[model samples]
Target: MLENWHDVNGLIGNSLIYFDRNDQQWHQSWIDTNGSSLALAGGFIGGVLTLSGTKPNTGELHEIQWRPLKLGRVEQIWRMSLDNGATWTPRFRGIYYAVDQQN
Candidate 1:
């Protein structure tokens, strides 16, 4: 589970991720304070965990990727496509590190 802070418009998001052994895939269920929700599923691809799915009732394709970096850091990128993936727009990009490394 994860939560967001200091988000614009006071929108807070919560997500749950898990790996399903039956299909050997990772799945994620995310919901926000604004009533938005998403369900994505995928597994490691080229060393990055990539998950993608379309938004409910919106037809917007959303993809998120997490890449591990050096020094116990990780990068997360979220993108969306409105035209069935013909084009993509970045929605969020963040780097996360351990608390002890926050210097």
Candidate 2:
């Protein structure tokens, strides 16, 4: 999957999600206009797609989850743990809806 968007401050961001059959896991790479980037790897857990990893430069642990909702919508949550996963703080949360193609 591919995604591109800009925040209210006009910070362009892009991400790619793919499945690596060799490891049987899903991976995602994200980068933003601020030159920040992140890489995470994991698979579905309890029906939710959760991926997590640490930032190579900052060592900050990050996790992102995508949950399915009704009417083909989805909820995405991004979290961060500065204390080695001992405590988590929500960084971003957004709901996504499928675009109507027949428009």
Candidate 3:
């Protein structure tokens, strides 16, 4: 579930992958408590992703990175850092699978 700084419920839709002309970085757009924004950026290599943004209400900073896999299924090893990428804490590992059928 998604929530705002005030703890109000929010929503997120399908991810949009695009290249930001301003920053010259690849990013995925999503809607969160902070409205629609770039939630993830294509990192250095090996499917590494990074996220750094400020909270809407409290102005708190957030930083996270992960390496994702998506050949047959979706999986990621996500990590979070509070001190400007100085250190990271393994929070959770997630995976999802889906199939398509035609009648």
Over 2-81, each residue of candidate 2 has an lDDT whose tens digit, in order, gives 98978888899999999999999999999998899999999999989999999878989999999999999999999999
Q: In candidate 1, what are the lDDT values of residues 1-103, reduced to their tens digit? A: 4555547787788888899999999999988877889999999999999999999999999999999999999999999999999999999999988796666
Which pairs clash in model 1? none
The TM-score leader among the candidates is 2
- 43-102, model 3: which lDDT tens digit per residue? 445566665554344433445454545666655565655665677677556565566677
How many residue pairs of model 2 clash at the backbone?
0
User: Sorted by lDDT, highest first, which candidate order results?
Assistant: 2, 1, 3
Identify the leading candidate in terms of lDDT: 2
User: What are the root-mean-square deviations of the candidates from the true structure over C-alphas?
Assistant: 2.1, 1.3, 5.9
lDDT for residue 89 in candidate 2, whole number 0-100: 96
Ten-residue segment with the worst summed lDDT in candidate 3? Answer: 1-10
Model 3 vs. true fold: TM: 0.47
Candidate 2: Cα lDDT at 13: 96
* Candidate 2 wrongly placed segments (more than 4 Å): none
Q: Kindly report the root-mean-square deviation of model 1 from the true structure over all alpha carbons.
A: 2.1
